[model samples]
Target: MDLKLSERYEDYREAVRVFLEEHRSVWRQPMADSDGRPSAAGRSWQALLIEHGYTCRTIPKQYGGHGGKADILESFIAAEEFHRVGAPTGLANQGISMFVPTLLECGTPEQKERWIRPTISGEIVWCQGYSEPGAGSDLANLQTRAVEDGEDFVVNGQKIWTSSAHFSDMMFVLVRTEPEAPKHHGISYLILSMDTPGIEVRPLKTMTGRAEFNEVFFTDVRLPKTQIVGERGAGWQVANTTLKHERGMLGDPGQANAMLGRVVAIMEEETLDGVRLIEHSGLQDRLLRLQARAQAMKLHGLRLLTHGLKGEDAGVARLIVKLNGTILNHEIAAFAIDVLGELGALYEDSPHLKDRGFWQTTHMFSLGLIIGGGTSQIQKNIISERGLGMPREPKPASKGA
Candidate 1:
């Protein structure tokens, strides 16, 4: 594939750089909340990004986006420029990153008009309600029920590992709408307000000292039947769309490369026993291996984009991104901690902690991502059956059989 950019793209890159420089101070300010919700200033910055065509560039202006024509190269250039300067590309949340794309693909025109604007603009926050006590990896086994009651579906059951559910305004959920149908066939996708009666959110605290994940319980929650995204019993397909976007969002190349840059910076600047870590032959080999892997992932991302533009199937290349990207990010953060040596043990709030304990935080959070969107084992199964033309994994026999 050609790596060289045309003159127009070159100008686009320069414009992105100038935009970042002009708004660097404003973007640099910390958000009031750290658990993925954007603050007022952060939302303003996101709006600025939309206005300047730096983010949501392909989504239509009617939905509060840039409404530009599809240009993967330009999008990539903007991302590169933002990461190059350590500026946030835009506000990425469950609402903007995952749900908006799904809604654009499967939602009715009225649904888009009602939700997309506030969702992308950070005026509305959304949480996913897919995983449950029994349905995490084997999501078809979900037992959450939403029975029809006149114009509404009375929902009851629970969803665990729901990130930001406690603070979200809405949810895109899956439920067993047709109990007599086959497991996958019985599911339906529905959207509902989080503030509805009979809904409860209990936050789950992680080892990182954050209560971002939650267990959400719905007790006879009434949602209008009109809130269903696709036809009843077609949620599995619609959810696949959301899952694809979720994986892409979780396995962000820009964030991975940025974290690698931070690791490299730490290695060059920090000394171990009076010798720089980068100068050590053993450490140099490790860093080189990581840099090589990072470059490969970047090239793979470009190849995926190329396939997308050409209307070609990406095969396993697309499926491998989330698994490999998450592992690579975790390994890179682990390498930074190793480089930090004793200082790595120090958590945030310590005056002597390096990079304000950012690497340590990443190390923990990255591990959760490996399990969040889908586990590494689950991803391998998908690559094998879906990408490699292999036979599907055999299901376990029944108890009496």
Candidate 2:
């Protein structure tokens, strides 16, 4: 990988930096209410991103995006800018980073024309419906059934941990079309309108005191057969497309780098035993290691993007990045808690709080990253089997078999 920024990219980087600096005040506002859900301001911030055209950075111009190269370096730069200013980019990350890419890769021409443009324009919001009550880490074990009914599929089952489901207008879901087949096969992907009858969204509050996720239940919810993205019974393969999209967004360097800076800033401001937290050698050492890991991960992300631009298979590098991102997030949260001491235990809006109780919030939110998309153990399994070509672990015996 060249690692060198051309003059044009240099200009782009500077422009992003300037924009973030200009918007720092607007972005620094408190995000969640006492309940931990995104405030109305957060939604407004997302609309602001759309208005400013930043939300469509990686989207194709034909699809109403800027259509600049979707390289990791540019994305990193943009993410850093947003993070530095505490921007509301995460609100749109799922829509822009995951769903948009999935649409581009697997959606039919009409699907793209219908959904991509509106999504990029912020006219519609989407949530993922992959994790079921019984099938989170073991995604193939999902039992959500979608029976073919004329020109539509009648979906029935419950999905849990669906982020933004309460606020989203649409959902991308994986459903079992053939239950007798092997667990991984006979699955199909579908897009469903959230307002459809028999669809229920029950938001769940997390340790962070927010309803960022929901338990979505569907009972004979009818969706157009045209909603299927790939061949029926081949949803497993198509689901990989969405997973890859998700991994890329989660492993973005800019987000990690920005987060690291925030963590460091908080540490610097905090003191313990009459000494600044950042001055502690142990903390400094850990922070340094985290910084190095984050930088390496960023470069790895850029390398993957570069290979992608060259039409090369990036393979399991994404898994490595995801693992690293989750680790870094946890480490940063831990460090923040250590620095804040007892104060960290206080939730948002508490008296004498630092950064509106971000430490506590970060600690709570970091665990979600480990469980969302894929678990840390699942990522390890993928890396061992797919990346390192190791033998798969022996399966456990069935309880009653």
State each model's CA lDDT, in order: 0.85, 0.76
Q: Write the per-residue lDDT of candidate 1 for residues 118-199, one digit (tens) a residue.
A: 9988888899898999998999999999999999999999999998897789999999999999998999999999999999
TM-score of candidate 1 on Cα atoms, chains taken together:
0.91
* Alpha-carbon shift of residue 158 in model 2 (angstroms): 0.7
Least accurate 10 contiguous residues by lDDT in model 1: 243-252
Relative to the true structure, candidate 2 reaches a TM of 0.81
lDDT by residue for model 2 (1-401), tens: 36777998788789887876776666677654554445566555555565555666556767766665556556666766666555667455356666778778888888888888767555577888888879877889999999988988999999998887877888988999998899988899788889999999998998777787889999899988888888888888876876665533533566666677887887788777778888999988988988887788777767777776566777787558767787778777877787677887777667888777776777778888876767888889999999889999888988995
Displacement of residue 50 (Cα, Å) in model 2 is 7.4
Highest-scoring model, TM-score: 1
lDDT (Cα) of model 1:
0.85
> RMSD of model 2, in Å?
4.1
Q: Please, what is the TM-score per model? A: 0.91, 0.81
